[model samples]
Target: MKSFHDKVAAITGAGSGMGRELAIELAKQGCHVAISDVNENGLAETVEQLKAYSVRVTAQSLDVANREAVYAWADQVVADHGKVNLVFNNAGVALGATLEGVSYEDFEWIMNINFWGVVYGSKAFLPHLRASGDGHVINTSSVFGLFAVPGNGCYNASKFAVRGFNECLRQELELTRAPVSLTSVHPGGIKTGIAQSARMTKSLEGVLAKDEKSAKDNFDKLFITTANRAALIILKAVQGNKRRVLVGPDAKLFDVMVRMLPAAHQRLVTSAARKQAARSGV
Candidate 1:
């Protein structure tokens, strides 16, 4: 869609980070925004911030992992706004652990929100979006979706799944001749609280506490983009109807690297991860 004015966008994980930024930006562009997150306090803060813009804003506490809740929220959003033009399956969590070290519980926790949440959001909002006849689904994958990191197997898996799912969803939309479009987003380390805010499994806790300095140093090197800038790029990509949007230079470079030299890229990533672990004394 070339314009967002008067359009209604439903966003998951809208309390903070890219989601919050998206809400504010869309509201500024005169679009009505329905923001949802499990963090009620954060959702309240987002609502307060969005008040400056003269647009309709709705906030709800949501746990995207809950399928019923997600579906209900989708219905409620359409009921509240009369139509839904965009659905941003942006709810996600970060988990870091080697495949061997990660627990099934932790893995499931991440998957519910990261992978299954996308599924729920897409399916729940799809019918309404089609009925609206002006719809787009924006699924948030990560640069980790493009490349695997040794200590972040859980995160990597979920993101990769999201990427694949959204791609297929896009193709299906095309076949049906639906006005709905799908876009997969791969964002490089934007300065979000994900590092400090993500749920930690025992394995992740061990690494973070024992090697906090090294972890911080490594992240400092990789985190190069801000959430606001990432949101701007994402909005532009949506307007341009891009099938895949890479947010940051790091994401773009890694996307190319994986496509051109998958094996070599894997080796490079492995080496770098090992070096970081060694430096961290982990």
Candidate 2:
């Protein structure tokens, strides 16, 4: 885990954002990479960038929500790269809706990719990682995973599930002395297209009383960290074998706030969200 030289890594959601940056950074560290994403054009672009490094690189157009596709991709990664040492279950989507406003269909859509995707990726590649004898799994959660947000019920659920699942996996691995380690990442807002690409439920507009563009702009303004910086922190976490890695100062601050004032933190978040909604003429 300390060294990535010649290691083979399989990353999901590598079409853009932190996933793409991770692939590029890993390749620079002499690691062969198998990158997958549903965005074919983005995947191709990432592949082109990775070519600057000497390490072997492969790209696959993949939907992480599809269990069959994810499993098959994992197999192919190992087959092509010879062995898999790291699995970064980083595919995730955002849903802007309250629990009452979110349809079961939309909820399921987010859950499948954000939570089940992590589960499928971890289960599919775990054996191969174990066989590699120096394996690690990094699952991406969000700051919302540490603290709930009013309009992000579905997203919070999926990310919180990822946090719990990875924590349990880490403990089980430790107990069994498994050759694999796991890290749960809680990232603060980073400069990514997730907000722009998010599915905004009608309920979100109804509740916030704001137009979609306004909401998106407000969300975008919160992105204080760049994707490349977040990727670098994640890579360092992997090298240091950290169980939980917070991507930005905001994430670290939120973690501490939630821990120190659990009940007060909820009130604070609720107040802030209400104020935001009020400002939007809710």
Candidate 3:
């Protein structure tokens, strides 16, 4: 965990955002990267970028929600790299809607990729990482996971579940003396294409058009952190053996608020979200 040099890292969602930046950074540090994503074009682009670094880089199309496919891919990674030192369960999507307004289809779609994908990634790569005797599981959560949001119920649910699951996994690993450790990542509004590229169903499109801020508004107001910065923070947290990682200034603020003043934090978040919803005409 001190260094990524020569280590083998398997990263889900490596096609873009923090995932892509992690792969690039790890490769620069001489770590072999196994990058997988459903976006073949973006995956190929990431692979091409990684080739400039002096490390092994493998790119593959993977749907992390597919448990069987994830297991098969993990097995192949272990076969190819001989051992897996890191598994980043970072694949996720955003679905913004009120609980009542969010469609069952949208909820299921987001859960399948965001929550279930993380579960499958963790389970699939765990054995290989354990066999290596030096491994870390980094699961992506979000600020929404820490607090309830007005129009992001589905996203919050998935991320909160991830945080709970990873916390339990960390405890079990400690009790059993497992070689692998876990870190739940809470990234606050990185400038990823998550909002622009989010899966907005027809039912939710009306709301999005009305209140959810245009992509430009999101970029300006919500997305204050860069993907590369987020990736660097993640690596540092891993090396420091942190149980939880806050990837942006906003995330750090929320972490402190929730820990130091739970009641006040809850009220503040609720009030803020209500205000946002009102502004959006939701």
Candidate 4:
């Protein structure tokens, strides 16, 4: 648990960003990795990046939203690596739209990947983790999971669900005295492609942004940490057995804001958003 040497890890969304960084970092620590992502090119790129490390690495083109594929990948990780010690359910997507205007299809899509993917990964890897006798599950939630935002309803819903799910599972493991542990990661805008890859609906244009491009642009400006740094912080948390980790200074600030303001944080967020729109002349 304190070290990754010779341990095996399975990471979702290992194609790019934090997932990819985590894989590379873990490999540097001598951990064998089984990595999966929907993006074939990105997956291949990650595999290439890990070539510098001496650890065993396996790549699979996987859709975390597909329950069957996730379960199958879980088995494949065990099959390929002999045993899996960690599962990083880090695959996630973003949606920017008013809840009222968001299509059920969009809502379902984000939920499936962000929330249900964590559930499926946790369940699928748990037995393997138990068998390993030393295991951990790291679920990526978001700072949005800590507070609501107008144009991020779907993303917020999905992340909040992950937070709740990971918390309950962590507690259950403790109650059972299981050898496995869990950590919910809330990262605040680590520099990544998630913004450019996000689904930005027209509903946000007038309500929160001048246009979808500007919204994405604005979102990009919030990223204050590098994926490499985020990965290091996360691994440190896992080593310390933290049940929750907030990445970046912004994440820590947001956590304190919500803690101090609680219900009133909604008003503060709304006020900030309005001021931002005014400055951008939205």
Candidate 5:
């Protein structure tokens, strides 16, 4: 995967955010792209933006959580593009609720999109990737995967599952000397609509914020990196065939903090949460 020129990439969540930027950047590098999202309008807009580049582009209105749809899309991407070399399993959602208070419905909703979506995309695209002779799967996890925090346990669980799943996938690839590779992406907050779109329940109001609005705001404040910058970092990691990539400075810092103080880092997170709660007059 040293070169992206003339490569074909299939991306989930390309309707916006890092997924959109990754498609644009790959197109700039002369890669043909097949992008999909549940957001049909956003996919159309992304297709329009990609027109500036002289590369084949196709868009699919897809729900990655649906295994049948994901498998069908993978076949169609190969059908339209002839061959596919990369797959970015980037579709995800967030839920803000305490682990104790979060309903099975909300937990299942996030897991279906955040964790199972990655599983579906990876499993569906892998055979095609192997056929292409040069293949890579990029599964987006999160900094929360590295360390747990209060109030959003389900989000952390989803990310942690992705982290574990990809780690195993990468090892199996190496052990068998598979032509396909995997990159587990642990992104710190980037400026994305995920926070705004995140479902915040009353369970998180007094616990993490004074209200749901401030909870979303608090999530936004952690977005210290731009989506474009994060996308660039991820592309570089994929080019390097890295097993794991950290997106932002905060992610890198958190990586080290967890490594050096694996057990005690929760204390730091607890302190920060208290400060945040105080500021919100919670």
Candidate 6:
């Protein structure tokens, strides 16, 4: 954990965003990377970019939701790289919908990837990581995981589950004195395609935006951090073995606000959501 040099890292969702940035940075530090994503083209592009570094890089097309696929991929990483030192369960998606408006299908889609994916990745690679002697697991949560938002019920549920799961895992690891450690990452908005790619409720078609592109543009404007900066913070957290990491200033502020206000914070969030809903004519 102290040094990434010559260590092997298996990263999910390495096709873009923070995952891609993490892969690039780790490669720069001489870490061999086994990167996977559902987007084959993006994964190939990431592999191409990783070639600039003098480290071995492998790309695989994977959907982290599939438990068998995740387990198989873990085996393949060890098969290809000899040993794995880090597992980054970074694959996630977004959904924009009220709890009542969100379909069971949409709920399952987000939960499968955003929450269950982390569980699969962690459970799948844990033994391999332990075998490596010095290993770490990093799971990505979000600012929404700390504070609920009206239209983000599905996403909030998934991320909050991830936070809880990783927290318990950290505690169990501590109790067992396991060689492996875990970190729960809570990132504020960053420049990523998650919002653009999010599945929005049809009920908000008129209220939010005329089209998905406009909604994405609105979201882009709100993003306060770059993916690379977030990646750097995550890597530092891994080195420091932090139990919880807030990737951006906004995330850190939100964490403190939630802790300080608690019940008052819920009222503030509800008020903001009402205002937004009113503006959207919802």
* The best candidate in terms of lDDT: 5
Candidate 3 TM-score over all chains jointly: 0.93
lDDT of 6 by residue, 164-183 (tens): 99999999999999999999
What lDDT score is found at residue 170 in candidate 4?
96
Q: What TM-score does structure 4 among the candidates reach?
A: 0.99
TM-score of each: 0.95, 0.98, 0.93, 0.99, 0.99, 0.96
Of models 1 and 5, which has the larger lDDT?
A: 5
Model 4 stretches astray by more than 4 angstroms: none
lDDT of 2 by residue, 46-153 (tens): 999998999999889988899999999999998899999999999899988879878999999999999999999999999999999999999999998999988889
Error of 1 at 81 (Å): 0.8
> Which residue pairs show collisions in model 2?
none
- Order the candidates by lDDT, highest first: 5, 4, 2, 6, 1, 3
Candidate 1 Cα outliers beyond 4 Å, as residue runs? 202-209, 212-217
Q: Please list the C-alpha lDDT of all candidates, in the order they appear.
A: 0.88, 0.93, 0.86, 0.94, 0.95, 0.90
* Model 3 misplacement above 4 A: 201-216, 277-282
Candidate 6 global Cα RMSD: 1.6
What are the root-mean-square deviations of the candidates from the true structure over C-alphas?
Answer: 1.7, 0.9, 2.1, 0.7, 0.7, 1.6
lDDT of 3 by residue, 6-28 (tens): 99999999999899999999998
Candidate 1 per-residue lDDT, tens place, 1-282, comes to: 999999999999888899999999999999999999998998999999999999888888999999999999999998899999999999888876668877889999999999999999999999999999899999999999888887788999999999999999999999999989999999998987777676554564455434544454556567889999999999999999999999999999998999999788889887776666666666
lDDT-wise, the better of 2 and 5 is 5
* Cα lDDT, model 6, residue 201: 72
State model 4's lDDT. 0.94
